[model samples]
Structures are given as structure tokens and as C-alpha cells.
Target: MERPFSVFHYGGTTSYDAHGGRRSRDIPAGEAGSGLGGGGLHRLHHHTDHDGRPAPHREAHSESGHGWERLVFSNALQAVSIVSVVQCGVGLSNADVVPKYGFGPIIKFLKVLVVQQILWAVSLSLCKIAILLLYSKIFATRAMVMAARIMAGFTAVWTVITVLIAFFICRPLSDNWLLDLKNRNCGNQPAADGTMGVLNMITDIAVLVMPISYLWKLRLETYKKVALIVTFSLGVL
Candidate 1:
């Protein structure tokens, strides 16, 4: 019988004062807001998987070997969250990201919105790559490994395309935030954004469902299979 595949483990640090207050300190607030705070909750110790694949984030392989991926993603997300909070503090919210005031206010709001979207795209790309790495580490079958690699490649391509589109939607780049343009022409941004949003939702569904076949085909109990499917499906959210 094929053995059960185990998950990867890595070292993570959490800082807190002696009083044990401000749990927010243990998890960076920005990372928490962005759903990347799970890394910080992981224990700061190393444990190898059954397959002997050292935890990529904890292994002494690269310059900043330990928790590098988590750190990079967490920091990026934290910065974005901080800036977003400041933007919201200055009267920008879900109700109205764009203001109906002077040209200066409109441009400022647009700039903040653009920055938020760019950071969100970068965080999403980083998280996708991390997920693919973790999936490959845990799933040993050739098909499973190949599927993860293919997904990672597609994610990288998607990131590049989306970033390029965001930066170049309007010529001169600055035109994206400009309040008025007399002669300069711009493409149909709402249509492009809708296409990207649809593609993103489709890829998310694909990633969430990719392992169902392998999971259900396992020689496990029916209850266990159902439990696994339910657990993995949560990633779709």
C-alpha cells in the first residue's frame, strides 16, 4: 500500500512582550489582515517530512535560508496593509475609493488605489508560488508533482501579464492616475479588468480542485476522504 504523504514544516518566529498582551505583536497586523499571518503562528523549530525533503523555507540553502519566503511575503503584505490603512484613514473606503472633489483629490485617490492593487497582485503571486512549493513537498506522485509545477509556471506567467497590464493600461503610466487627458487615448480598462478577474477566479478554482482526484483515489476510509476534500476545498476561499 502507498504510504500517507506528510506536510512540510518550517521555523517561524513570533515576538511578544513579557506581559503576553497585544497578540497582534505575535502576528503582524498587516499580515493578519492579508491572510499571510499563518506563517508566524508556525513554531520556530524544524521538523523534516517523511520523504526527507527539508522544509524549503527553513533549510540552509540560500542566503537568507530560514523563513525567507514567509518573511518576504509577510513583509510585503504588511507594507501594503499599512499604506491601505493610511489611505482609508484619509477618507477612502469601500463605500467610495474615488472622491468627487478637485483634480488633486481624485488623482491622489486613484494613485492609492493603483498602489493597493499592485501590492495585492504581488502578494497573491508570492502566496501561489509558496502553495505550489508546499504541495510539491507533500505530494510525491509524479502526476501530482508535475501538476504543481505547471500551476506554478502558469502563476508566474499570470503575475507578469497582470503586472504589465496594470502598469501599461495607459500610456506614460502616470496617465493611469491623471484626472484629465485631452489628446491621449486609453483602452477599455473595465473590460480588461473584468477579463482578468474572471481568469483569476477560474485559476483559483482549478488550484482548489486539482488534488481531489488523488485524494479520493487513496486507499483510505470514506470519512477520511470526505474530510480531506472538505479541508482542501477551503483553499478556494
Candidate 2:
């Protein structure tokens, strides 16, 4: 962790009846650590699962600790969530800083955003990916996973689309300095665009429908099949 250098500000004595004006005390908005507004809502805290992991949960660990895979996944999810929230808060705080200080401070803040937001977004994506992967635990068969992999592929494609739209697609050139002259003119094509949308619909239907289709192979009641499929689908959505 890096510690920032702090400067001391000394204001003159109080001017108000009760030690007097706004100057009598220091008031900072968005109370962070403790007190009334201390929940630190809309802020990014930490992200341990920077690459890939599932949503957080608590699990019993073996004495060896090496077998604690589930515990690692759950803690990773919590970390990812906190980091994302903190990133959002930091972005919002940039606006407050700009009004109070200037672009000099805000520019430095943007640098932090580059690293933090990337990690936060990755964390959120990893959680979703982890949920999708949880399907493997439900039906750990090669054929089932092949179908599930199709679902995952669509997810990856859609994630890319949303990310592109969120960051680079809007302005194409001016708003984003990262884009180049040749790239700015290269916009999305409708034929290519429809593929992702279709893929998404197909994956959703396939993920749920395939399991039900496979129910004929199992020696279970119609009610049991319906119950199992519906309950599992709930987890997916």
C-alpha cells in the first residue's frame, strides 16, 4: 500500500457566535471510515481475484488448508464486489475533487481509475464467469460441459461487446485518446452485430433447454425433472 503525503492547513480563530462560521470547523462530505455515512457506499475497496474466480461464499476448510478451493473462490467474490463498489465511489469522488481542487488533482485521480476500474471490471466479469462455470458442478459430464462451453463462449462474446460499447465505441476518436486514425473509422457492422445477439439468445435457451432435453435419459419423475430444471435455471438467471 502507498501512503500519500498530507499538507497542513491552518485557518484563523472562530468568527461565529458558537465559534462561528463554516470556517470554525472542517467539514468533508462523504464520511468514509466511520460515523453516519460510514458504509462507504459507491466505493472500491479490494480485489484479490484479479483474473478469474467465483462469487464469494464461506466453506469449511480441511486441516491441510491446501484443499480449501471453495473457500478461496468465495473470498475472491467478496473482494471483487468490494473493489467494484470502491471504484465507483472513487469515480464519483473525482467530481467532488474537481470542484474543490482542480484538474491537476483530478488528472492524478484519473490515473488511479485506469488501474482500479480495469481491476474492478475484471473482478465483476470473473464473478459472472464463475457463476457460469458453476454449471459444471451441476452436471460434470463432457457432453454437458461442451454445451455449457457454448454458453460460456456466448458470454465471453457479449462481455466484449458491452465493454467495447462502454469504453471505446461511443466517441470513436476525440473522447478517447487511445484510439487511432484508422481505428476510429472502423465501426461495427450490422451482420456482425446480429451474431452476438443471436448467440446470446441461443446460449440462454440452450443452457436451460438442453438439461431438460437430457431428462429423458434419467430415471426420474416428470415432477422431479421440472423441479430440478426450474431450480437450477433460477441459479443461472
Candidate 3:
């Protein structure tokens, strides 16, 4: 009897044989069944048996240890992003709250705004770190893994610095929300924001380009490489 095979539709279509061996159309024949392609999510695609039912195999255990790590980071990013959006909707809009009310509402808005800034920095950092972790898992090259670790560390340090700046930008921290308070010494708000914004863009671009080199080296067709690159580049948007 002929062995069973299963076809799965991930970013690209890939077929698996009876022994849980992957054979992607885009990947060369020699490279097929070497290891799983794509990220951790690809591991979810299982091979089928002669009856077309899902069958478990050793490939399912490939990089299984990092599953929880990815889940935790992804979940944390979603939770933080959701809370940031909710907080912004409730009390952080300067245009909506400032014109309709007096200093009382303005102060409240500023307070929420401060918290929102910290959350924004945190959420952004979490997103970058999550991407780096995914890179480390999927690429798994020594250089790629080292770069991912360095970038993750940099992202964490950047988040801490951003939060610290948000908290201590104004001395006697109350002055952050206390608009009319006397003897307030605040740093250059616009300049600081501009600098951070530029730095954030730099980091974003760095992360976006990190995988391109490794991806191009893969034994894939040009169109497939472009498609893969475009898919990864969507993070910029």
C-alpha cells in the first residue's frame, strides 16, 4: 500500500509524508524533511495517517520547550496593548477632556497620560522582544541567536529608560500633572520626545531587517523569498 501524505496551508503550502517529514514546494528537494520550516506555529500542523486522520510524530517535539515562552510573551503583549487602549479611551484624551472641563479634569487627564506613556513604552518593547524571541527560535543560527539576544536586551533597557524618563521628566513628580505649580523644573519635553521617537524608529528598522539576510540565504525560489520577506516586513505596519 502507498504511504499517506498530508498537505497543510500555512503562509505557504507544505506537504508532509507518513513519517511526519515536511516537503515544501518552495524548498528544494534536498532540504525537504531536514527540519520544520516557519515559526513555532508551524509545528501545530501534523501529518495524517492512511485514514486521513491527524497523526502525531517526533517533529511535534521540535523546539517544544520554547512554546510556553512564546505564548507568555505574546499574551503579555496583547494584554498590555488592550489595557493601554482602554486607558486611553477612558481618561487619556487631552483634546476631549481638556476643553470640556477645568484644571481638575486636565490634571486627571495628565495623570492618566503619564501612565499611558509608560504603558506605551512597555507595550512597544514587549512587541519587539517577542519578535526577537520568535527570530531566535525560527532562525536558530549562532549569529542570529546572538543578535536576537542582544536586541532583546537593548529593548528591555530602552523600555526601562523610557519609563524612567516619563516618571522623572519633571522634578517633584507632582509637577508633571500640576500645571500651575510654582518652581517646577522640567526637562526639554519636545526634544526628549523627538529623540526617543527617532531612536524607536531606529530600533524598529533594525528588527525589521534582522531576518532578511538569513532568509535570502535559504534555498527558496525568488518569488517565495520575496513573499516571505514581505510577510515578515508586515511588522513595520
Model 3, residue 171: distance off in Å is 1.4
lDDT of 1 at 48: 45
Clash pairs, model 2 backbone: 16-20, 42-89, 43-85, 43-86, 44-85, 44-86, 44-87, 56-74, 57-74
- Tens-digit per-residue lDDT, 1-237, candidate 2: 433221111111112222212223432221221222232112221112343222123232222454244455556655654554454344456667667665554444434433443344344445445555655434444676776676667667665665564455435433333323465543463554476557656655655565554443333456765776686577655
Q: Model 1 misses residue 187 by how many Å?
A: 1.7
List CA RMSD, all candidates.
13.8, 25.5, 8.0
Query: What is the C-alpha lDDT profile of model 1 across 1-237, one tens digit per residue?
Result: 433332222211233333322122232222322222333112232344565433436454443544566567568767766764664445454346445433455556566766666666666777776777656654444676898888888878887777778888888777877666675466778998888888777778878887676566544567876787787787645
Q: How do these models rank on TM-score, best leading?
A: 3, 1, 2
Give the TM-score comparing model 3 with the true structure, all chains together.
0.63
> Which runs of model 1 end up more than 4 angstroms from their true locations?
1-78, 88-103, 181-184
What ranges in model 2 sit over 4 Å off?
1-128, 172-198
Candidate lDDT values, in order: 0.59, 0.45, 0.68
Worst 10 residues of 2 by lDDT: 6-15
